[model samples]
Target: MQIELLVFIVMLGAFLLGNFLLKLPVSISMIMGAVLGALVAGEGFPLRHLFEGTFVYIDTILIISTAMIFMKVIEKSGAMEALNVTIVKRFHKIPAVMLIMLMLMIMFPGMITGSSTAAVLSAGSIVAPVLLLMGIPAPQTGAILAIGSIMGMAAPPVNIPAMLIAGGVDMPYIGFEGPLLFLTIPGAIFTVLFIGMRYCKNLNYDEIIKNLNFNMNAKHGFKLYLPILTVLTLMVLTRVLPTAIPNLGMPLIFMLGSIVGMFTGEKLDFISTVKDAMNTTVPVLGKLMGVGMFIQIMTLTGVRGYIVISCLGLSTVLLYVAIATVMPAFGAVSSYGAASVLGVPFLLALLSGNQIIVAAALSFICSLGDLMPPTALAGNYAAQIVNERYFKVLRYCLIPFTACIIFGIICLIYSKNLSFLV
Candidate 1:
């Protein structure tokens, strides 16, 4: 094997050894990989590069921190409880409406940030209790949140995976919204509907309604969600109405929302909530830091280039199986990493057809990495929020995961008919 590819093998081995044998935290395992890569690069510990690599995703780190604070504030302020009670009562009889609304609510954060962890930890944390109360098993709850969050990340306006693939091939991010939406929406609807039908009959509406914990005496019942509304409105104004409002990025917007939220009903401990948010973000931040180092090394050593060239020689039949397997399985590391490493090569290999279908199909496959094992960030985090084993969550995730891959493959095989996708 080439030196780059050999180093990559050592990196994976070190990572696994650290995680399973040494019993380190997940971030430390990733850091172990980076350390191995750096040593293999013969740089003798490049301190500056290691430090710089940690901050490569500072924006995403900030978003995760602030969004968790927003969620915690709502929890402390009683807004979350109030909103859930109202939603439960409103959708009590209609299981479909309950399922769809809950999924959409869980998905809202991902829609804005294009980050699955954000969706799961923030909105997923809020809805998880309700799902549990409705008798959805913990694994199923985690799976539902994870599936919904991935759908949101794959959808229009802020799809990071699609953006990565599109940017890789010099395709405009615009005009892709339609095709990507088609890739995600149907799967999302099916996931929620199936879960709801399976579990909704167990919901004890009367007990849930009777136990409303928050004092709902505020004249503006809907306005209690102003903090959340503010964040959403700011995100919309920044992206959709750029001329009218300065684009205060996600972290700042979430901070402002948290501050505004204290005025809603109950007083909140700003410092405590922020600290809690920070605590919640610790693992994610460290993972990013470690992963960043590995990615930096990958870019520097040209392992990504080697993989691209190697994969191009596969037949079309093998190509489909490879794409379906690698993108999601390797996603156990990071979907964005998988996208950057393999997306362009796959896109190039499959270029005998329409760009839109190929791009969406590639994104769809990459998006599945959100649920893939090891570092399946979305499902793992959802498991954390819902207090369940991450692997158990993966068990419930199999059906939706299978469905998404099937849809993606069909899109690829029939790309000719999908010219309308453009």
Candidate 2:
């Protein structure tokens, strides 16, 4: 009968009702949840808290918006296509290596945008025909894209889930690159090899090449990739040189890359590309805003404190079990929601471990929610790209998905030992 627990239930019920019954966008559902939770707690709308919550992820919104614009530039400019073709051409003889490289390529946009849907739609679309040509089953190909895209969403430089958890705990979004790269790079390699390597062993260079969009590579060659290189170089320079180069934040960095991209490949209609990018990005930006409001309300109503305290009472064993199971299951709503709702409290519960590493691992686990049903954004899109039912893809993902959860738990348990990553 605790008011905090009641408020939490009301919010969750409202979210599910809005999301499932009303078929509202996840962001809008979250807003409904927030509004209802406030009402239940007798906070009476609290416009100030709701508006304040929206700004919680303002920086993340900027980064994702600009990053999507950058992704659109690369896609439109032929940079993405050229890179995909180049990778296959270079590594096709070694099917396993080629598959791994292609998987990493699929992860690229998600890594930048912190969205598995971005990865699945952008790189996954391009890679699907190649995988099919390599003789991988459609279901497995979908699984590969789903898993890789999720890993990319969990990767460093723009991990939204990690940012949410860190923000929840008042931790700065620094020192995460090492832990995130540690988890995602190896995780991506494993998922690709596990799902696609055996099927890809019998190489089909001729067919894959036939399907490859080679026009971009032939037209612009290396220049087609300059924008990607420019952004990566800037990222590295800002990190490696620190004082030498100004730290252009992710938004500025992405914008700089987009600007450089305009001249390096096929010409782009600047206004259309920007408009298209914004159109695609607005929903996700709205989701983050909703998450901010949802969490802000949770904090205001003592629901956040209730969850944290409840978690603190559990044994470590139960904590890990809940994290591995419930966290991903929550992704049916939205992975970002799972992070803000559960990941923060879990991180607090596991404070005995290294925070950055634990946060990274938690984010990885939360990213699996993108593969969960209904709103399985990555899985659904990946399935569509490969012409497979998402359930079939989910069946194929069983082993790799379990492995990822296990690896994430291992990261959580031995976080201090893995401090070398930081």
Candidate 3:
């Protein structure tokens, strides 16, 4: 028991230190801590083998890293830039229509890329300029981009969090598609409408549209768009098509996209693109590796089991609140971590018929981490593109964030008797 506690403390401390002080990615910190914990618990303290086992979550990590590489290659090829500029130009005639169309455009890259950062960086570079040229405040532009990116995460294919959880739960790879389409899509649409309508209500739509810059070099040949379009089509097909078609998984498709992107243009250089993609891929993969290690260490140390037992002791209502609140905190730090720690147990609890309400409640609350301050990765990316403070951007996001949480809670309450739907 003492050794287990020590392992937990050391691992947790290392994770925090790496994240906050050393400025290292959380995954690296987690790996270091896990290694240390395993040594300490297995030898010195002699607790039930801290590394009771290892699961090759590294495969998932590789898949994600390759996806990032694919996105980086596409971004470097200027395909994303072209897509953004094209969308803006095509919709310049109507500001409201432009906003809606831009929302969809952003969603496309975001869903395929799996990195909200990439999505915002690519989309915002174009959208922010248009928003600014139209006399929109930086804060407002930041808000729009941040909120739109959040909505995009709820879309198909590249939703990493949803994918992780669904995979962990052994549901169909795309099982959440139906629920997300039914729930998050409508929720996102309304959220966009409400926010966009509120922001643009006072603006002169004609004037905004007239002043927009419709011409730019952010154009690409049809070939560059093909890979992205193909990927998007596959994603949609995965949702609707039969499972036996040997559907290309998202990671491989992305890798193929990168290859296609490299040859699509006169300026495109395959070697440089591959190298550039690797530069981005390495760090991302390292971090993911570290996260997997951390999760493994936690499992070995029995801390995760302790957490589960503790939660199980609580009444269903209290458990719901506790999990709803705590999961968001972990998610705020790392969505992957949240999925591993909170998501796994939440799923287990639900399967066991204990804290089922809380388990369901977490599906929504966990998303808040993506929008919260400090580590609000998605929001920060948006802010970076528009040159605004991450927290300031987060402030504007609170409205939609709150709405998602409230809706999730309502779902939890109602889902108690609707297990079939869940």
Candidate 4:
């Protein structure tokens, strides 16, 4: 075996052993993988290289951390809830419209958090009971929230997979919004309308609307919403004006947004919210740093290069098939993990004449990992909220999940010619 391949196998074994045998946390398991690779590769177990690897993805780590904090603050401040309630009131009379809105609302949390689990626990939980009462089958309803959250996580503004893929090539975050929006918007519509279609027919549209009449009283609803608006406006300004506004970047933008969020209705308890934010943020950041170490080992050992060259050896047809197959399957572990581990190699191997669409397509595929099993974060969380088994939820997710992969493949096949989309 190639030295890189040998090290990779050993590291993977270390990861599994640490997780299953020693019962270590994911971050610690990854560190153990790094240690194993170092031992086998004759790196002499240098702490410097390990620390170096951990900081390789520092920018993404910061973004993920700050964004999680911003999300926690928004959730705690009652802004997200207020926003959800506000959206419900507009279309409560029209059941299908309300469902559409509800799906979008669920997606928003994921879009903002770049986490399907957050969406499921936040908006998905909020809507589950409502949808259940509408007589939607538990499986289909779970599927709806799953698809929506997946697409939302893959959506433009803060897509972690996109950031990872783009970082591989040193691409700027600009211009992803357009291609990603194209991928996710169509996904949201197709899944909701199709998966939700059956559930809509039996729902008493008028009755659901009447019950959605509950309104939240914010001191100033618009002012309460200013933080979200600030974040969006700053994002757009950075993209459109570029040089006009100093680019504070995502972390700073998130921090600023969190600050503005404090003034929202029922002033959020800052200490508790920050404590809550850090509670969730630290673990994710730790896992990311661990992945960074794994990636660093790959870089040092030429494993990433080996993988890229291996992909390059394959025919175009085989390459796409393999890429599509492995991405979602690996998602059973973690989407970000799949994206960073495979996406970089794919980026090197599959240069389809157009960089933007390929990146977007890859990110879209990786995002759907939430629909697959084992970890099936989005589906399991949605299933829990709906009181259904995850596999049952996955059963309903099959068509839409598979459909997204096919759609992404088609997009890749035509990526070069789809510049009109951007």
Taking all chains together, each candidate's TM-score versus the true structure is 0.83, 0.98, 0.82, 0.94
Q: Over the stretch 1-422, how does candidate 2's per-residue lDDT look in tens digits?
A: 99999999999999999989999988999999999999999999899999999999999999999999999999999877888888889998888788888988999999999999889988899888888888988999999999999999999789999998998889999999999999998889998888887787678688778777888888887887888889999999999999999889999999999999999988889899999999988889988999999999999999999999998898989999999999999999888989999999899998889999999999999999988898899999999999889999999898989998999999999999999998
Model 3 Cα displacement at 421 (Å)? 7.8
Q: Which segments of model 2 are wrong by more than 4 Å?
A: none
Best by lDDT: 2
lDDT of 3 by residue, 215-297 (tens): 32424457767767766666667656857456676677777767776766436666776676567556545655566667666
Each model's lDDT comes to 0.78, 0.91, 0.63, 0.80
Q: What is the model-wide C-alpha lDDT for candidate 3?
A: 0.63
Question: Taking the candidates one at a time, how many backbone clashes does each contain?
Answer: 0, 0, 0, 1
Compared with the true structure, what per-residue lDDT tens digits does model 4 show for residues 1-422? 89988988888788878866787876788889888888898886868878997897788778777877788777776676676667656665576677778788888877877878777877787777667767788888888988999988998787888888888788876678888988998888888888876666656656655654244444455676778888999988987798888888899999999999887655678888878877866766777788888878877777778877887898888989987899888786568778888987787776755787888889999999877776577888888888789888888788888888999999888888888767
Our tally of clashes for model 3 stands at: 0
> Could you tell me which 10 consecutive residues in candidate 2 have the lowest summed lDDT?
198-207
- Point out the worst 10-residue segment of candidate 1 by lDDT: 211-220
